[model samples]
Target: MLGNSLASSPLATLGLAKCFHHSAGEFATYTNVLPLGLNSSHHGLTGGVGTSRNKWIVVCSTTQVETSSEDPKTWEECKEALSCFDFSVEEKDKILGKAFGHIHSPYWTEERAKESPKVETLNQILEFLRSLGLSDEDLHKVVKKFPEVLGCSLEEEMKPNIGILENQWGITGKSLRNLLLRNPKVLGFNVDCKGDCAAQCTRCWVRF
Candidate 1:
């Protein structure tokens, strides 16, 4: 039965959004992100000298954040982090909005929201995905699908799961990349339990 669910959707057995939740302590370590001291004036296209014209700009809207508290300030950091990607302003807004909503829902209290992952962590997640050979379009789709991924611990969660997919299931290169796009939720699974999870998925695929 578990294998059947994995064959249908790799994350269905784990419960969709529940897989992403972790103890507040897991997020506490990331709360000290150095603020960029950003303000309404900082909103605009950002490109360093000699940088390629194709690079996307960090476009911050004055209206994106409504307060000066730590929670809202985290949104500013998120906007800065997303600037490193190739997404357009509109795309960035959508991604940022989704992330903002996810972290602010009833599931996340004011304290947890304030302790959310910072700019540096968010960039690390994006860079890791890019290293996996995801194009800009694919990256956008994954982030939009699983905004909670921004809060995941790279060393603890993402890498281990990818390792299981490669070493255990032999899913690599293009096949691995396509699988991730189809089921970005797989990244949220706790690494310690992922081996058994992937094993079940393997059995289901073999049965088919």
Candidate 2:
């Protein structure tokens, strides 16, 4: 009689609705006897008025999103992947975190990590930038800000563009360094469109 009264009450259904949306971790608590098919998985409820009186049910969904699978690889895998590049543990940590400015990007996946571009090519680019007078610390900062620079063409792209900024625009040495720190994206700008590229760089420079 008590179970039938509770199950048929509209107030009990309202209370159940309130419980469902309470919070992520909390769950509704109730006790009742009902027909076997009275509960609904979609409606998130169980129990009903039935003549059987011998069965009870509890229904809820336990689905949860998995975030760990999104991570490309472990720290050890990152170190091993970059093994041929002469990076220390600390340096590897920085490189992994700042490679694409956000380690969570799809580029950090295991497949992409395995297919990383040639270490020798990246070394040449790093060396050229170092030759341009950026210290190791400054180079890391630049790479952190714009990791795509590692994949840029040195002869046809980076050199000509950097030369124009320093020579044509008179942004050399300290000024150039300041400009890079202010907007590292300029390093990846297309030098083929020198006018547009220089205009964008100038605008960004003026803003800072």
Candidate 3:
């Protein structure tokens, strides 16, 4: 069902260009500028310029270059990084496509996209989820629905939220799995707010 839904998802139609429009003009301008000692005859001189978290970066190469803070990972690279997982090619594509669609969301930024998540960190997340009894299919569905989960801190956001659900509200086993599949975004909710009424209400609802 998740696979079928992804096939018809609007994110499937969106391109990297659309999500990274903020840097389009800058990229075009830098690409056209010839580096010293290179002329129009130098056919392979490719360059890109953009800002990440306010730091300006210029990348140019005759061949492909490594990703840096200034040049974060593309959607393709993000998918490739997840190759260690058991996801099908189509599933990987759909997952990253949905993720790229959220470039401007508070959880992600244009600059962050170029760098992407580290392989080691992603592995930790997968392992943690597996420890909670999530199967490969469940993992795929959760990531597909809320790809930003990839960006959440393992110890800070994910662990604490899951802990609250299990320890405070007794939502474990099948109920926990069902809740995650139904709304993975709940893991990102700020359930630790001390005095906020909204957070208190959320806690109340969970207890009920």
* Residue runs of model 1 more than 4 Å from their true location after superposition: 1-74, 84-114, 191-208
TM-scores of all candidate predictions against the true structure: 0.50, 0.42, 0.50
Residue-level lDDT tens digits of model 1 in 1-208: 9777666852232222111112333322222112233333433323111111211122333223222233333554676677655665556544654444432533122423423346777778888999999987888788877666666568987898788788998999999999889888677565243334444331122221
On the 0 to 100 scale, the lDDT of residue 7 in model 3 is: 66
What shift in Å separates residue 103 of candidate 3 from its native position after superposition? 1.7
Q: Positional deviation of 156 in candidate 1, in angstroms?
A: 1.0
**Pairs in clash, predicted candidate 2:** none
The segments of candidate 2 whose C-alpha lies over 4 angstroms from its true place after superposition are 1-115, 191-208
Residues 13-128 of candidate 3 have per-residue lDDT tens digits of 22212223135356422221222222234333334223333232222233222223333444345556677666754565445433433234444433335434455776788788
